[model samples]
Target: MATASMADKAKAKADTLIDEAEIASSASAGDVQAELENLRRDIAALTQTLASFGSGKIKEAGMRASEIGAEAADASVQYAENARSSFLSAEQDLEAHIRNKPLQAIAIAAGVGFLAALLSRR
Candidate 1:
């Protein structure tokens, strides 16, 4: 009779422990779900803010790039005009020099040809 009473007491203790464990698991699941919801809300808010800022930044950058492109085109036109002027001046000088020293120019040309031939052979 004493053994039977002890067995009943052990079974009651086991049932109580199982009930406490189930309650604790339920509470933990509720906490995890709440945390997930809060995190989702935070991510959505941040995504909206970043999208707004990115659009403004893209517009500003496009305007800046357009301005820079216009400036570069103007500079290129001016450089081409300067290069044309310099080339014409050099051509005129060379013409005058060749007219003044025809024989000397011929000798220089022959020397240059000889040097080119030697380099090509190597």
Candidate 2:
């Protein structure tokens, strides 16, 4: 009868330990679930922030490209104006030279024409 009582006491202690272990395991699972939820929220916030940052950078790059295009167009216009000015100046100088030496200019033209005809025949 005493041996039976000792075995019963041991069984009761094991049952209490099992119950405590089950309670601890359930509490740990709840804590893990809460941490996972927090992590999901953090990831969502980070993604939104990155998206906003990317859009801002793209907008800034577009504005910079537009500015560069405008600068290039302005430079092209200035270059065209300079070229026109140079062409007009050369034309005026040639006109002045022809006026100052009409006979010499006629001789030079005849020589150029003769040379051109020779080259064409070849």
Candidate 3:
């Protein structure tokens, strides 16, 4: 009769422990779900902020590229005009030299022609 009482007491204690474990698990699950919701909201806000920053950076980069392109085009036009002026000035100098020394210019031209013919033969 005493053994039977001891077994009944043990079974009641086991049932009490199981019930407490289940209650604790339910509370922890609620806390975990709330934390998940908070994390999701935080992630969404970060995504929006990053997107705004990216858009602004893209606009800034495009404007900078346009300005650089315009500068390059202007520089190219100026360089072409400078090259034309230099070519015309060199032509005028050559004409003046030939007028001042016709015999020397003819001798130089004949020597250049002879050198060109010799190089072409080889």
Candidate 4:
């Protein structure tokens, strides 16, 4: 009878330990689920932040490109104006030279025409 009683007590103790272990494991599972939810929310917020940052960077790049294009256009216009001024100055100088020496200008023109006719024959 003593041995039977000891065996029954050991079985009851084992059952109690199993119940405690189950309760602890359930508590740990709930904590893990809550952590997973928090992680999901953090990831969502990070993605939104990165998307906004990328959008802002894209807009900034586009504005910079537009500014560069405008600068290039302005430079081209300035260069064209400079070229026109240079050409007009050269034309006026040539006209003044011709007016100052009409006989010499006629002689030079005849010489250029003779050279052109000679080259065409070849």
Q: Stretches of candidate 2 above 4 Å error?
A: 1-28
Worst 10 residues of 1 by lDDT: 23-32
List pairs with backbone clashes in candidate 4.
none
For all candidates in order, the CA lDDT equals 0.97, 0.98, 0.98, 0.98
TM-score of 3: 0.68
lDDT of 4 by residue, 1-122 (tens): 99999999999999999999998877877798999999999999999999999999999999999999999999999999999999999999999999999999999999999999999999
Better of 3 and 4 by TM-score: 4
For residues 7-118, could you state the per-residue lDDT of candidate 2 as single tens digits?
9999999999999999887787779899999999999999999999999999999999999999999999999999999999999999999999999999999999999999
Q: Please, what's the RMSD in Å of model 1?
A: 9.7
Choose 1 or 3, whichever is better by TM-score: 3
* Model 1, span 31-98: residue lDDT tens: 98999999999999999999999999999999999999999999999999999999999999999999
Give the per-residue Cα lDDT of candidate 2 at 107. Answer: 99
Superposition error at 31 for model 1 (Å):
23
Of 1 and 2, the candidate ranking higher by lDDT: 2
lDDT of 3 at 115: 100
Q: How many backbone clashes does candidate 4 have?
A: 0
Per-candidate TM equals 0.52, 0.75, 0.68, 0.70
Overall local distance difference test of candidate 4: 0.98
| Backbone N/Cα/C clashes per model | 0, 0, 0, 0
Question: Which parts of model 4 have CA positions greater than 4 angstroms off?
Answer: 1-28
Model 3: CA > 4 A from native: 1-35
